[model samples]
Target: MLELNDISYMAGNRTILQGISFNVRKGELLMVSGPSGSGKSTLLRIIGDQLSPASGSIRLNGRSILEYRPEEYRQKVSYVFQTPTLFMDTVIEDLEFPYRIRSAAPDMERIRELLPEVGLTEEILQKESRVISGGEKQRVALLRSLLIAPDILLLDEVTASLDRENARMIENTVKCLSARGMTIIWVTHDPDQLELSDRVLRIRDGKVVESIA
Candidate 1:
């Protein structure tokens, strides 16, 4: 569903990604594993169009990503950062914001259902977002992203900081999404996460190597 051809990026004189290329099939769960500063996140940012590649191109559905409007592209390809940002006063407000932007009413029932799936409760949604723990905040951010039902989900170490239980919750939730045909590109260092992937690519020094399926 998505293809990256000879992708490269640079930060001033430093290279971030060099000659990176990969294809993520529809409904496939692809795991990107590498040490810090290996360009996994950069690869994701490029795919999400947050960073322009210095060379090469990204295609979604056989069309260049540049062909789609920025807002429209982002809606279809969602990126969840490792450290989730919640600027809203309450969790519910954060969750409702996406629907509000589309000028549609919030789906309360779906929100309620999703909350527990991510190890959160309905009551927590009423609490102040700033007061929540990091894990809770991450879960809320994840739920907010899923509320939009993006076609491709780019997860950047989303469960890196969560406890085992919470991480499992997220893994299972993502597996369910994959089962439903959502393309997932997950960046994680955890070996368990690697074990669950349909394909794994190891990146180092901005290069892709040691791919397994």
Candidate 2:
């Protein structure tokens, strides 16, 4: 469903990625694990269109990624950063953003169901973003985007902050969503996280080294 061909990127004088190519089918969970500075997250950033590649072609559903409107493309393919970003005063405001942008009413019942899946309760929504613990903040940030349910999710070390139990809970939750047809590209350094992947791709020095199915 998504394709990348000979993707290459350079940061000033240094090469961040070189000749990377891979394709992920619909509803696939692709686990990326690699050493620091090996460009795992950089690959996701480029795929998410947050960074322009020096040379490459990316296609989604047989159309060039560049052909789609930026907002529209991002809506279908969302990227969650390693660090959470919640600028709003309350968590509810942040969760309401997807509905606000689409001019659609939110399914609060659906949202409330998702809360406990990520180890959060509905009452936490009224709390200030400043008062939440770091893990709570991250979960809320991740949950905010899940309210809209992007077709493809790009997660960058997303569950790393949580303890193993919570991390596994989050992994299982996302895996369940993936089984229901959401494609996921996850970058994680933790070996235990690889358990849920449909396929695992290991990269070193900006190139694929090991691939397991």
C-alpha lDDT values of all predictions: 0.90, 0.87
List model 1 lDDT by residue over 83-148, tens digit each: 999979999999999999889999999999888777788889899999998888888888898888
Model 2 lowest lDDT segment of ten: 161-170
Summarize candidate 2's per-residue lDDT along 1-213 as a digit string, tens digits: 999999999999999999999999999999999999999999999999999999989999999999999988998898888788887888887887788788988778878988987779989989988888777877787788777778898999987777776677678778777788889999999998898899999999998888899
Alpha carbon lDDT of residue 123, candidate 1? Answer: 86
TM-score of each: 0.95, 0.94
Q: Pick the candidate with the highest lDDT.
A: 1
Q: Best-fitting candidate, measured by TM-score?
A: 1
The C-alpha RMSD in Å for every predicted model, in order, reads 1.3, 1.5
Candidate 1 clash total? 0
Model 1, position 103: C-alpha lDDT score: 96
lDDT of prediction 2: 0.87
lDDT of 1 at 41: 93
The regions of model 2 sitting more than 4 angstroms off are 103-105
Candidate 1: where is the Cα deviation over 4 Å?
none
